[model samples]
Target chain A: MNMVVCVKQVIDPEAPPASFKINQSDNTVVPPSGIPPVLSPFDENAIEAALQIKDAQGGKITAVSLGINLLRDVVKKPLSMGADDLILLEDEAFVNGDSLSTAYALAMAIKKIGEYDIIFCGRQAADWDAGQVGSGIAEILGLPCVTLAKKIDITNGKARIERVTADGYEVIEVSLPALITVSNEFGEPRYPTIKGIMAAKRKQPIVWKAADIESESSKLGATGRRTKLLKLFQPVREGECEIIEGESPEEAAVNLALKLREAKVI
Target chain B: MADYKGVMVYGESTDGKLAAITTELLGCGRKLADDLGQELYAVILGSDINGLAQEAIAFGADKVFTVDDPLLKDYQSDSYTPVMEKVVKEVMPEIILLGQTSLGRDLAPRLAFRLDTAVSMDCIDLSIDPESKLMLQTRSVYGGNAQATFTSESSPQIATVRAKTMSSMERDDSRKGEIITIEAGLDPSAIRTKVLEKVIEEVEGIKIEDAEVVVAGGRGIGSEEGFKQLGELAKILNGAVGASRPPCDNGWISDSSQVGLTGKIVSPNVYIAVAVSGASQHMSGCSGSKNIIAINRDPDANIFKASHYGVVGDWKKILPAFTSKVKELLDK
Candidate 1:
């Protein structure tokens, strides 16, 4: 079995509030100081999902990423974690692409990669939280797609998965050649070992440009994007917080409950 | 130019009852439809759900489209997508709104992809641009650090809004609307995915999302034993127990009890965050809570900034005292 996993580099979602800066002109986030870019946390889970399948099924896993600059550290992180190969869809035109255009470029890359049994993607990117690219890719490739799978196992040309639902979870089974978006409930991703890191240094990722992927320039970037970002701003918080004061923890707790009761919230 | 007419909202139902988010979507859809001078239509797919269709109309839908089939009872992307695609083709609504629940998150993107459109997920607010007549969808990004407004250039603007963010319209049984029964034409053989079984994690007490007050614990809770104190406090207050990501990830609590960007976004009237450091991810989920009371030993904890009330102390000491105080108050 062969598999492909889509990974993206995003500003760490857990970064401190003060670290982020907004560029009003473009309505995009500026990379924070002292905080380096990391692979989207869920994408790391995607790599782990693929690695687990390869470990059990005896197959090669290819990690695909689309972005500009394509940091060396971020690009190799998947390979270091046990992906067999890496494909970088790098071009100036790919920078401002929205979910649909990004999916279009990735579907093209997968078609070029040719042989594959399944594809894996993070449930959603921590940055934009769009959660659309995986299904979009599946639609473009004309394959069935499942989102938010907490556990997945492939057997007899079919993949059985436990997908997350609102109240609980449901067991599902889909045939091979499908796309699955993994959720964090799948479990913690394994950290790369020293030997794996050394091996990653020797395996260089194949770089592809817009022309190499044969995508139209007009349909590959900001021009091709179906959605337009109007503005990026923080919502102004309303109401002043009144602190309940007391000399001791017990007294404070008493005063707090009284305040909630006074407010009719209790 | 495309002549897209009505505003369509996908009405989601569970156990023969309409989901709260469906009414919330209709509330927003009613406003957008009124602004666009288009009718508001609610599309429900399920078996024996005519009652839900009437409820949709009572909650501000001008028209309801019902597709009742046994295959539609369970929500599978492969089974529902074709039927939805067929409905959209026939109805041709200009704006499509859905709740960002599990089903919506799974279905909206697939439908958008099939229709060759784009989707804005987990939006907090929706409005219509008077000039362009396009739907402006606003959603929090980067774990609630900022909100971005998105507008799609495609024919049908698709969006999924977070639950509890928008108000649901009051149900008025006196209100009358049209109900159109549509043929699903679903082929059971075409369904690729099969449902093996559903495992519902049973949680006692009011669900964390629907609770009026939520008592949430974080890494500062120390151990599973600490959660017991939280449960005690919640029980005294007639509320529910929630947790930050660490406790849930560490197996100290169930994943369903998690309150954060990745877990459940809640907006209880009062939220008591115990031993929680208030990471932005966790804060985003509960920021909508009316009153937040943070109890942590560290005075500089970020949670304090987002809290309405702060009690700087050890949770081990604070929780027991808090529970006793609440119990005493309730006893009176």
Candidate 2:
């Protein structure tokens, strides 16, 4: 089996909520200083989905990422987690692209890779939280697609997936050469081992620019955006939490309960 | 602008009635259509959903579109995407709305790409720009840390509205509207996937989304045993127990009890977050609560930023005392 998983490097979602900052001049996040970027959390689940398939069927997993100034350490974490190869569509032309343009670039790169049984992507990126690129790529590739999958099992050249639903879950079956978006409910992704890290350090990622993927210049980045972002701003929070007080911790708990009742909030 | 005229909403049904989210969309669509001096159209698809068209009309839709087919009984993306594509092209609506739901999340993007258009997903606010006569879609990004307003240049601009963010109009049976039936015309061969089974693991209590009061735990809750205390508090308060991602992911609580961006978005009258640090993603789910009460050991925990009331102490010590005190007061 040959599998392709799309991963993205993003600001650490686990960073302190207070540290999240955005630049108003441009609609972009101001990356927190001490925290280095990590693989988007759900994308790690996607890679784990591919890794599970590879482990069961003895196949190869190729991790694909699209961005500008791609961080080798961040993108390479997929390889360190047992993916066979890493492909980066790293170029200036790919910067600030929305779902439409980003998916188009990824579809082109996947076509260049030529052969694959399955394609995996996170349900959504942490930064933009659009949750559209996976579907867009499947549409552009004309491939059968499933989104928000919690579990996937391959049998008789078909993939049986447990798709997450509002109420519960639905088991769906689709043929091979399909695209699946992995959800966080799939379980934690495996951490990189010392041996896997050593192997990944020895392997250099294959980087592809716009020309390498043969993408349309006009359709590459911000120019290719279909939706114009009129404004990006943080919503102010009214921090007026009246901390319940007492001499002791237990007394504070009693005061809290009393306060809720007094305020008619309970 | 001449080619596209009305505003369209893709509606869904639950247990044979119009879904709450669909009604909300119709309500929202009604305002936008009235603003544009156009009509509000609603579309429903299912095996035996003809009855819902009239319900949609009563809930603020001026016209209703119905597509009845066994193939569409389950929302397979392949079938629904094309079906919607055909309907949107034929209807020629200037703006289209869908619920930010399992069906909409799976369908809107694919449908938009197929129609060579653009979509704004999970929008909290949507309106028409008076100057340009274009739809302004505002959505929470960065997991509710920031909001972005977007406008699509393409005709039939699409957006999926978040659940409960928009209100449903009061039903008026006196309202009159037209009902149009459309042909599914789906090819079984074209459907590449099958839904083999559906498993509904409902929590045995008031659902967090519907609860008046919610007691939520987080990583600080530590273990399954810890969640049991939260359950006790929820039971005493006549509410439901919820969890942030860590507790759910850690298997201390069921995944259904998770309240976050990827989980359920809930806005109860009172949200008591126990030991939750209020990450932006988790905050996106419960920030709409009328009052937020947070109890955490760390004084600087982010939960306090958005909380209305707070207690700085260990949940293990505070929760039991708080629960007892509430029980005592309610007993009187």
Candidate 3:
């Protein structure tokens, strides 16, 4: 078996909300002070999904990422977690693309790699939350796609996937050479072992530029975006909370319930 | 240029009736269509869906298109995307709206890509720009820390709206509309995916998404025993129980009970958050509640910022008293 996982680097979403800032001029996030960028949380789940398959069935996993100035430690985290190879499509030309451009680059990269039975991606990136790139890649590559998968099991030549839905889950089966976008319900990703980290540090990433994929310059990065961002801002929080007071904690609880009743909020 | 004219909604239904999001899309679509001085159209695809066309019209659509086929009975990217692609190409509507649901999340992007267009996912609000006549799409980004609005120049501008953010118009059975039928034209061999079974992890009471009241706890809730207390409070209030990511991650509750950015988005009438140190990620799910009441030991917990009423106290001491008092008042 062969597998490919797509991952991305993003500002730490767990940072205190107060630390979040946007550069109004560019509508881009200003990395919070003292907090380092981490791999987008869901992408780790995607890698875990691939790793789980590799654990059950002997297979090689290749992790692919596209971005400019990706930190070595952040991008290599997948390799540290047991991925066999790391491929980076790093170039200034790849910056600020929407789902179309981003997925196009990845699809092209996968086409160039040429030997894969399955591809996995995070349900959505923590930064944009668009949740479109996986499906875009599947459509561009003309592969069967499943989104919001919690588990994947391979049998014969097909993959049985537990797909999460609004109410619960559905068991869906698709043939090999499919794309799956993993959701967080898959479970916590494993921490890299010390020995694994050492191995990762020794591994060199294969870098691909715009020309390497043979993609048209007009359809590669920001130039390929089909949508335009109009504005980005935080909506102001308006109301001040009225605190219910009492000497005893139990008394405050009683008073809080009384307050809810009086305000007709209960 | 292709003549892209009206606003269209890709409506959904289950158990023989329209989904709530479908009506809401029609309600919103009605306005956009009227603003453009065009008709509002709805397209529903499924087996035995001829009866739903009338319901779509009652909701606000001026025309309903039905593609009745067993292949579409279960939504698969292979079957539904191509059918939608064909319908969209033929109709050439200026705008398309879909619910941000399992089907929408899977279908919208593929349909958009197949049509050589783009789509905005999980939009909370959408409107047409007066100047550009473009659909202005606004959605939460960065774990709900901020919002970004986007627009596109592509024909049939597409967006998937988050559930419950838009209002549904009153159903008027007297409303009149036209219904058109389209052949499914599906080849069974093309669909590579097969749905084996649907398992519903039925929660014992009112669903959190539909509950008027939601009683949610976070990491501060110590164990499954703590969730039992929340369940009691939810029972008393005729509501549902929810938890932040930690409790669900810790196995204190099921993942379905998790409420946050990655969890379920719930917009209820009253939200009582207990022992929750509200992270922005968690707040994204419940921030739409009409009134928020918080109880936490730390007055500085981020939950207080979003609460309409708050109490600084230990939930272990506070929750029991609070639940009993509310029960007493309600029983009277």
Candidate 4:
């Protein structure tokens, strides 16, 4: 089976966040300092899943991504993680495409690259946290898709899966050529091996553009995406906390309990 | 322009059972549905989910629209999105709602994408104009830095709501609703991704989301051993130990123990934030708490504003006393 995994580069979660002042005049986020970027946390789960399936099923894994020059690093990281090929759709024009647009680009790329049995992505990229891209791809491709998946198994040509739901969980099974966004527990992300790293150093990814992918420039970027970030400043907080006074540690503990009981937790 | 007159609710569950927010959204959905006279409809996706549809009515749904199939079972992006898109195309719902949990977070944007609509996620409050039926989704922006009102102009506008933001409806066994089963006619072959396993965190007792009392800690606990201090506080009080996004991000706490927008949006009756500075990102997740008590040496800490009660002091110095007091009260 052939598979495609989409990955994105994002600001490292550990990086210190810089505050943004809303541009009241424009109602937009005054861009903050760009922090060190890395592969989104969820994307790592996809890489892990792809590697596992490749190991078990003997299929080729294609690493697909859209970004800037940093695509080199992002593409290599997946190669190191065990993807057999890489397809990078990087350019300034592709930046800021909302889920619909992103999926459109991905679908175009998938079509350009021929057929595949499945597509994988992170549950949601840590940076955007929109969690929409994978499903958008599914919709555009008209494929079956599932998000927040913790478990996925490919046996006897069909895929069996498990995903987290609001109330509890579910066990599901489906045929492939599906798009799946992965959760952290989907599998343990693999570490780069010396051989794989060396192998990636010699490999170059195919980079596609909006024109190359045959997407109309109108539906290619801002025009294709639906939502707009009118404003991005942080929201205000409410209320002043009252410090409950207690006579001793034990007293404080008792006061705390009273607070809980008073609040109806117990 | 079309009138945004109707109220809509997204009915979803994890283990093939209805979630508390489904009831709450339904209860709230009913109120809005009643105000608009357009009717309250709950949307559910996944196969074999008909078994769980009854509870939606008990929470007050006039109708239930369900798309059931084996492909819909585990929430694949491929299978679920079209089903939702089909509903939006068929009903032209003025508004759509979902729980702000993991599933909700993943699905909401995808639905918004299919509808080619705008989305406001992690919202705490939702209000609709009685006459216009326009929905103003209220959510925390800039990491809880501010509270903002959001509106959508396109078709089937969507929003994902925080858990505990609305009260779950009381169950009424006598209630019932009309059921509409939609085939969605989704092709099984197009789905590319699949789930392989299910690993529940296996936590015991009430989840932090459902907890009535929460004992939270920040950096002031001072040591890895300090978590044991927080754990003691949690143990004596029969509550969960949570941390600000900072501590959890800093590797001082487990990711599951994280409390913030990306972590878990929770509201307990009483929330005690110890040694926490109350960053907006962390504070937004706690907006639902009935009462908040902040403890810190910084008198001007950000947490104080969002907290209902506070003690200005060292948490280490204050924690033992707080524990003893609670023990003493329980002993009494």
Candidate 5:
């Protein structure tokens, strides 16, 4: 079996909110100082999903990413975690591409890579939270897709998955050569060991440019983007909090309930 | 300029009844359609779901499209995608809206990709640009640290709105609308994915997402027993219990009760967050609540920043007092 996992490098979502700054002029987020970029939490889950598959069925995993000025250190996290190889699609034009174009570029790269039985992606990117690219890639490749899979297992040449739903969960089975978007429910990702990190340093990723992937120049980046960012801003929260005054915890609780009743919220 | 016209909404149903999120989509869709001076249309796909078409009209849709098929009764993307693609080609609606539920999240991207368009997922707000006639979609990003507005350059602007952000419109049975039954030509054999089983967990009380008031706990609650106290307070207020991701991940609570970006997004009348340090990820789920009251031992807990009222204390003692006080008020 062969698997392809897609990963992304993003600003640390767990960083203190005050540290994040936005560039209102370009409608983009500015990475905070001191905090280095890290692999998206969901993408780590995707890699873990791939590793689990490899552990059971014995397969080679290739982790892929598309970005400009590609953070080599950050993109290599998957390789450190256990991916056999890494493929980076880096170009100046790849900057700020929308979900459609990004998926297009990825599909093209996958086609160039040739043989693969399954593809894995994070349920959604932490930055935009679009959650479209995985299915978008499946569409471009003309393959079946299952989103938000919490568990996956290969059985009788078919992939059985447990998908998360609003109320509970559902079990679905699909043929191979399919794509799945792994959700957080999959489980915590494994931490890279010292030996794995040492081995990763020797495994340099193969980098490809826009022209190398045989993608049409017209459909590469901003030119192929179907959505335009209109504006970006922080939502304003008004009104000062009225801290309930009390000498003790019990007193505060009583005062708080009284205030809620007066406000007609209960 | 593209000659695109009406606004279309995907009316979703669960267990033979129209989902509340579908009604919410219609409410927002009605405003967008009216602002664009076009028709408000709804597309329903399920076996024996003709009744939903009428409900769609009462909620605000001017025309409802029905594709009743047994294959579509269960949402297989392969079966529904071709049918929706055919409807989009025939209707040529300028804007397509859906609720950002599990179904919509699975289908919208596939449809958008097939149509060569773009989609904005989990939008909290939508408005039409009078000058360009483009749908401006506002969605949370960076774990709810910021909101970004986007417009599709393509013909059909596709978007999925988060539930509870928009209220469902008042239903008017007197209103009438057109119900068109279209042939989906669905071939069940073509679908590669097969559903093995669906287990709907039996919940004991009101769902946390639908509750008018939510009493939530976090890691500070200490243990599963701590959540029991929170549940008692919720019961007294006629509300529901919720939790942050930590408690859920720790197995103190079920994932269904977890309120965060990865969990359920809820907007209740009042959200009482106890023992929860307000992470942006957790706040994003319930920030839309009308009022927030936080109780934490640490006075500088991040949750205080987003709260309308704050109490510095331990939840163990405070919750009991709060529950009694709430019980007293209700007795009056």
Candidate 6:
């Protein structure tokens, strides 16, 4: 069996405030730089979900990715962590496209590579937090797709999937050739090993483009997008902070509570 | 002006069952669709999913897009996106909506991308412009320290709304709607990522994200034991419990319990905040809540600004009153 897990690079969420740059013209965050990059925390969950499937079914797991940073370093993390193959969707055109473009690029590359039993994608991208790539890829390929999956099981050669619903859970059974969006609860991501890291340093990453996957240009870029940013301005902050002055913990607590009741927060 | 066909809500599903967010979205979507003089259309996709389509209409949809294909038995990203994309192209829906649950977070953006539409995530409120019927999407940005309202001029103006942010309407069994069938053209070789296995993690089960009511703790909880009181309150409410960053960082609660930009974003119907000092990161997570009751010792706690009700007193005293009130209401 074969499985492919998708991973993307994200800025360390805990980085110092100064690490990020904002383009004054727009409220959009300038992609963080000089900050250490790691596998998206959610992608780690996706990879972990894939690893569990590979471990149980005994298959070669391939890690597919798209980005502009050091491809080798990013590719090596998965290789070291246990992925059998790594494909990098590296190219300028694939980089800036929103969720649809990113997903198309990934699907295009995955199609070029060959056949696989299943594919896994993070529930959402941390930086953009748009969470659309997996479904976008599913749309492009016209396959069965499930999102927000909390658990996945394969029995008697069919996939038994459970996803979170509003009140409880929605359970479904699916066959092979499906796309799944992994939840943060899918599994705890694994860390790389010393030996795996050493071996990963020597592995190679295959790169692909939007053209490689067979998509039209108009549908691949900005034209394909229907949403427009009418205004991107920093949010206006109103109402200054109010201070409740008091002495003694009990008095302070009481004073706070009194004020809270007045504020209707109690 | 082209015919304002009204708005559409992408009622989400899993397996053959409907998700809570889907119902909630339909209820809210119904209001918007009605106001716009357009019929509410709820879309559900998955194999054998039509059995669950009735709930959409019960909540308020005028019509449903039902696709039951063997190929759609399981969720595949590549296969489903195209089906939805194709349907939207044919329907030319004015506004498309989804719940900001895990599924919505994943699929809405992809649908937006496929349709080349713009999307606003984690919206707390939705309203239709009386004049244009353009969706007025309200959401908290910059970690919930602030809130913004927007409108989409783009086709299929898309927005992923948060669950529990709006009260779900009572189900009307007498309501009626039509179910339209859809065919997803798919094949074996088309799906690249195959499912060899799926392993559900052993994390603490459904949390605030899925809870109807949530009791949240903040810094003023002081210590781990401070949050212990929340457990009693949560149990009584039959709701989940959550905390701010300080408590989690202080190890008062598990990291999973933290609510902020770094943690899970939740929007329950009733959010009870205790001893929390609301920072932007922490506020963002809780802001989506529908009915907020702030309970803090501090009069100036950031939570009070947006809370619907205020209790300015020791949680030790205020919580007991609140819980007892709920118990009384339940007994009646």
lDDT value, residue A232 of candidate 1 = 97
Computed on C-alphas against the true complex, the DockQ of each candidate is 0.72, 0.88, 0.85, 0.25, 0.75, 0.13
* lDDT (10s digit) by residue, model 1, range A47-158: 8999998899789999999999778888899989999899998888787989888988999899999998899999999888889999999888988888998898889999
Candidate 6 chain B least-lDDT 10 residues = B196-205
lDDT of each: 0.88, 0.92, 0.92, 0.73, 0.90, 0.70
lDDT of 1 by residue, B1-332 (tens): 27788999999986677888889999999999999888999999988886998999899999999899999878898988899999999999999999898889989999998888889999999999999888999998888888999899897899999988888888899999999999999888888888899999978999988898899999988788888889988888789999998898788888889898778889998899998988877887899898898898888787888888878887786677777777877898
Candidate 2 docking quality: incorrect, acceptable, medium or high: high
Candidate 2: residue A31 lDDT (0-100): 88
The TM-scores, one per candidate, come to 0.97, 0.99, 0.98, 0.75, 0.96, 0.68
Q: For residues A17-101, could you state the per-residue lDDT of candidate 2 as single tens digits?
A: 7888888898778989999988899999999999999888899899999887678899999999999999998888887878999
Kindly report which residue stretches of model 1 are placed more than 4 angstroms away from their true locations once superposed. Answer: A243-251, A258-265
- By DockQ, the best candidate is 2
User: What TM-score does structure 2 among the candidates reach?
Assistant: 0.99
What tens digits encode model 5's per-residue C-alpha lDDT throughout B1-332? 36778999999986677899999999999999999889999999888886899999999999999998888868888988999999998889999998899999999999998988889999999999889878999999888889999999887899999988887889999989999989988777779999899978655698887899899999999889999989888888779999998787677877778898878998899999999989888998998889999999988787888999988888888989989998999999
Per-residue lDDT tens digits of candidate 2, residues B157-177? Answer: 999999989989999999999
TM-score of chain B of each: 0.97, 0.99, 0.97, 0.92, 0.95, 0.76
Chain B, candidate 4: TM-score = 0.92
> Candidates sorted by TM-score, descending order?
2, 3, 1, 5, 4, 6
Docking class of 5: medium
Worst 10 residues of 3 chain B by lDDT: B1-10
Error of 4 at A43 (Å): 2.2
Over the full model, what C-alpha lDDT does candidate 2 score relative to the true structure? 0.92
Q: Model 5, stretches more than 4 Å misplaced? A: B324-332
